[model samples]
Structure formats: structure tokens, C-alpha cells
Target: MAATLDGLITFFASHHAIRADKVLRDAGFATELASGPKELSPNCGTALRFELSRTDDALAVLADRHVQVDEVHPYVPRTDAWDRSGSPVRRAKRLWGRRS
Candidate 1:
């Protein structure tokens, strides 16, 4: 089977991740940028993932767009579902400083 969560990009900065996502999508590549799992990157909270077969193309596009990506990984997030409902503020308060 092809890589489901294929060309995952781990970026040093969230801005690069966000902009890369947009640029890829505009270029007709299905792409997404998300909060990098803490296990994957402690310095950055954002990353991008796209079709694995397009790794080279993706990198080229990002460079052309002037997005400074830190690293790229073969990542597949655990879940595809998203909570459109904003996370509750109470959860943030309760979990503040609890993360390692």
C-alpha cells in the first residue's frame, strides 16, 4: 500500500508550516499542516504532511515559496478527525503547565 500519511514535514516555525500548506494546496497537492506531536518536535508545534510520492516536488515548492522548513518526516497523525468546536478554555486552564 502507498504511504497514507506520507511526506510529513516537521518545521522549525509554525509560520513556515502554515504557508507551505497553503502553497501546496494552491499548487493542487492535497496538503495539511497541524500541531506537531510533542513526541516528534518539541521546538515547533506545527508540521505539514502530503503525498509521499510528492516529497521532492513538495520540497521544491516550499523552497520556491520561501518557506523555511526545518525537517521532514514520514508522519501519520493518529486521528484524522478534527474538533471544529473550539477547545474549551477550562481544558486549557486545567492542563496548563501539566505537559512535559
Candidate 2:
């Protein structure tokens, strides 16, 4: 089953991000390697994208493999006016549509 790319995983290093992509993929999770958003994390130049719904499983898998993560965020890039900037505009709404 393929999952939507709706979550962002930030890491302190590019190695961790890359390893996360591989680990998640190998564990049957959908993942993507993307340029790290500076506003979210300034430590690395890379980030891992994954399905927000599978966050718990993903994090557990990473933890079992001893992979360190800086943070996990539910991200839905604003598509209206900020889409062209290549930088995502975060909304106040949470990933599950509940108010944050």
C-alpha cells in the first residue's frame, strides 16, 4: 500500500535523513528524500517525507534501528500563493484537521 507524503522528518545530519529514507523504504513504508526546509530545521540539508498516518509505526521502526530524529511534523504545503516559492507555508491546522 502506498502512502501519501504528508509528514516531514527532520534530522540533525544528512546521513540520518538518508538512512531514514532507506530504513523506512525497507520496512515497507513510503518515503521521499527532500531538501530540508530551513524554517523547520537548520541542521541538515535533507529531510524525509512520509505518510502522517503511519507516524507511530515509522518512528517505532526508526527507534528499533537506532536511528535518531530531530522532530516529526505534519506538513501540508500551502498551495495558494506560496506554492511557487518552493518553501512551504504552514497552516495552523493539525494533520488530522484538529486545531493546534
Q: Which ten residues in a row have the lowest lDDT in candidate 2?
A: 87-96
On lDDT, the candidate that comes out on top is 2
Per-residue lDDT for 1-100 in model 2, tens only?
A: 5578999999999999999999999999989998887777889889899999999999999999999999998875646534434443333223337745
| Runs of candidate 1 exceeding 4 Å displacement | 1-3, 79-100
Residue 62, candidate 1: alpha-carbon lDDT: 82
lDDT of 2 at 93: 29
Candidate 2 residue spans exceeding 4 A from truth? 78-80, 83-100
Give the TM-score comparing model 1 with the true structure, all chains together: 0.67
The per-residue C-alpha lDDT of model 1 at residue 89 equals 50
What local distance difference test score does each model get?
0.74, 0.84
Q: TM-score of predicted model 2?
A: 0.76
* CA-only RMSD, every prediction: 8.9, 7.3
> What is the model-wide C-alpha lDDT for candidate 1?
0.74
Candidate 1 residue lDDT tens string, 1-100: 4335576788877887888889988998888767786666777888887888888888898899888887777765454232233334545555675978
Predicted candidate 2, C-alpha RMSD: 7.3
